[model samples]
Each structure stands twice: as C-alpha cells, then as structure tokens.
Target: MSVHRVYLPDLGHGDFEPGAVLEITGQEARHAVRVKRLMPGDVLEILNGQGLRAVAVLGESRKHPAGHGKTEWAVDVRIESVAQEPPISPRLHVLACAPKLTRVEDMVDQLSQVGAAAWFPLVTRHTLTPPKAERVDKLERVAAEAAKQCGRAWTMEIGSPVPLADALSRTHRAIRPSARLVIADPRGAPYSPDGSTDLALLIGPEAGFTDDEVDAACRAGAMLCSIGPHLMRVGTAAVVASGLILNAEQPR
Candidate 1:
C-alpha cells in the first residue's frame, strides 16, 4: 500500500529522537484522523515542507474545542525514523505571467508536482489579470498539496506578483549565474534539453509579450526559446516546458 503522507509545518521545529511524540492539529489532524481514519499503530509519513521526512506511527486521536465555536480533531504520532531528502539538481524556476487566479493555481500545482524549485508570477503588459496576496496563499496551499501527492518532501516557492521589469531583474537570484534563462517565444531558438542543471523558464501571457518587454528580458540575459510552433496558453506552456526540461535532466 502507498504510504499516506501528511504535511507537518512544525515537523523540524524541535529536536526529534526515536520514539519522540509529536502532536498534529487543525486541518492536517482532521485529514489524518477523520479522513484517513488513522488509528494507533498505523504507519504514516510526515513532511516538514522543507526536505525533512519522517516515518511516524499514529499514537492517539482527540477532540478539542476550536476557537470558532467548533470542535476540531488532533492526532499524536511517534516518530520512528527521519531522513533528509536532497534538493533537485540544476534547479528549475518558472517565471510565468499571471493568466488568472484559477489558472495560476493549476500552474503552481503542476509545477510543484514536476519538482520546480520556484515559481514567479509576473504582471506583464499583456497580462489580463493581476495577482493578489490572497491568491498567493491559495497557490502555496495548492503547491503543498501537490507536493504531498507527488511524494516530494520540498514544496515550491511562490513569489509575490511583480512587474515584468522587476521580474527580469530578479531572475539572476532565482537561478545560478551559469543557468540558462529561457524566454518562451515563437521567434527564438528551438528548445533542446542539454541536461543542464540550472534552468529558468519565462512564460508570457496569452496575449504574448510586447517587443519592448522581449528586448528588455533579452538585455537582462534571457535567451528567447520556442517550445513549439503552435501557440499555447500560459499554464500549458509552463507544463510542457517544465516536463521537457525535467525529462532531459533525468539520469540516463
């Protein structure tokens, strides 16, 4: 059976020894107790949202009063073992202009599943919608859930919405200096996965980027690359490009 995984934001907060007991509360507790129906002695896995993972066994379940006039369930688990997972190599960072909140959420989820190191939501001239802080929270939640589903210990970082110019200037920090900065454009070099470790992909809005924006990114040391001849939506382009890069990076 597939080991059920739960995200514990505080998993690495305290020192853990063998047989150490840890308490899990709130929605995560509900998922473990009510949804999974986990009982004492049930083996499960826990992630710290970093790279720390632990093998834990459920110890007990309890009902407690929540602040908002409701009862909530909490669970206790005993840590059996812990391990640190190494980060993905040649980190992949995707810089995608916001399409819409809903679409952006899906993009974040997909990228997280594909082991993207980070995601940047760019507000470009052709962007139809502006991303908000609330949506950033939603996107993070989606990424966390995707990480759990995909059996990844680390979650992708979602950056706050920023203008295209700001996003271009900050690209250097997102990846290594030697990493490739690929801007998705039709009139550019054809993409060929070179198994490079550091790659930052910049996906434009559905309406496409303006000439000045393209020139600015190129000046910032971005290489315009084409994913395909056909036009693709922002999310679709991200998924396809990320998949290709990841596939090429895989060990042969």
Candidate 2:
C-alpha cells in the first residue's frame, strides 16, 4: 500500500534526524489514528511544505482530556530518514482571472497537483467575480491538501488578487525577478519554452482581456502566446497553459 502522507508546517523547527521521536497532534494525529486506523509500527511520510520530508514509523499514541470528558488524540512517530527535494524547474506562477463561483477552487487544486509554483487571481477589466479573503483562505487549505495527495514536498502558494497592470509592471518584480511573462491569448503565437527558469503566465477571464490590456502587456516585455486554437474557460486555460509550460523542454 502507498504510505500515507501528512503535513507538518513546523517540521523544520524540530530535529528530524533518524531515531528522533516527534509528536503529531490535533487533526493530523486524529486522522492517522482514528480514520486510518494506523497502529504502532505503521509507516508514513511527513512533509514540511518547504521541501523537507521525513519517513517515519508510528509509535505510541495517547489521548489528552479536553473539557467535559472529551479527549484529543496525539500520535508519536519515530523518524526513519529525511530528505529534501529541490524546487521544480521552470517554475510556473499562474495569474488567472477568477472563474465564476466555486470553479476557482478546482483551478487551485489542479494547479497544485501539476506543480505550479503559485497562483494569483488576476483582477482584469473583464473579471466578473474576484475572489474574496475567505475564498483565498479556503484556496490555501485546498493547496495544502493537494500537496499531501500529490506527494509534493512543497505546497503551491495562493496569492492575493492582482490587477493586470500591477502584475505586468516592475513593481511586482520582487515576486519573481527575471521571470519571463506570458499572456494567454487566442490570437497569439504558438507557446514554446524559452529556457526561462521562472515564468509568470496570465490567463484572462471569460469575457477576455481588453485590447488595451493586451497592448500594455506587450509593451511591458510580455509575450502573447496561445496554448491551443479552441476557446477555453479561465480555469481550463490556466491548467492547460501551466501544463504546457511546465512539461515542455527548453531549447538545446
């Protein structure tokens, strides 16, 4: 059976050397013990979200009393080994106009699974429904869950909504300096990997970008590229464009 994985945001704060014992508490511990029925000696992996992963074997578990005779579960796992994975290359940062309703959640989930470094909602002239703070928080949770399911050591980041102009300007350079910017447009040139290690891909909304938006992007050194000939929804275009950029090889 595939070893179950759990997230530990503080994994780096503690020593994860072989033979060390670490306590996993709260929901994570409860899920492993109660839901998974993982007993002593069961194996699992713990990821720190920042590339540290530790293989561990389950140890003793205990329950701490909450008020009113309620109890919370905690599990101890002994570290077997630890490994750090390097970040994926040609890191793709997707900035797409939010799709209507809950479709944005599905977009975030798929982007996480496909190894997009991060995602930001693009606030464009044609954007109908921009994500709110609560939605952003929920998307972060979704990204965390996707990391565990996909066995990714690093979880994809969820960024706040960014306006098209700000996203294309040097003011945002600190976010991903030297990153090549690409805007997905139906009338653009064919997409190709340009040997850039970092990329920021912009996907427009259902109504599409204004003519001025596309023109400004071009003037700001952004390339207009098309993933396919057919029209795609905001979410679908984000995933398809991200996949093409991430999986393609750089010119030799």
- Which candidate number maximizes TM-score? 2
Tens-place lDDT digits, model 1, residues 142-250? 9999988888888899976667766577644655567777888989887777778888888889888999999998998887877887999999899888887777777
Backbone clashes under 3 angstroms, per model:
1, 0
Q: How many backbone clashes does candidate 1 have?
A: 1
Error of 2 at 150 (Å): 0.2
Model 1 CA lDDT for position 139: 83
Candidate 1 residue-wise lDDT at 203: 86
Model 1 clash pairs are: 90-197
Model 1 segments more than 4 A misplaced = 67-70, 167-172
Q: What is the lDDT for 32 in model 2?
A: 97
> What C-alpha lDDT do the candidate models reach, one value each?
0.82, 0.88
lDDT of 2 by residue, 33-94 (tens): 99999989999999989998889999999998877989999889999999988888878889
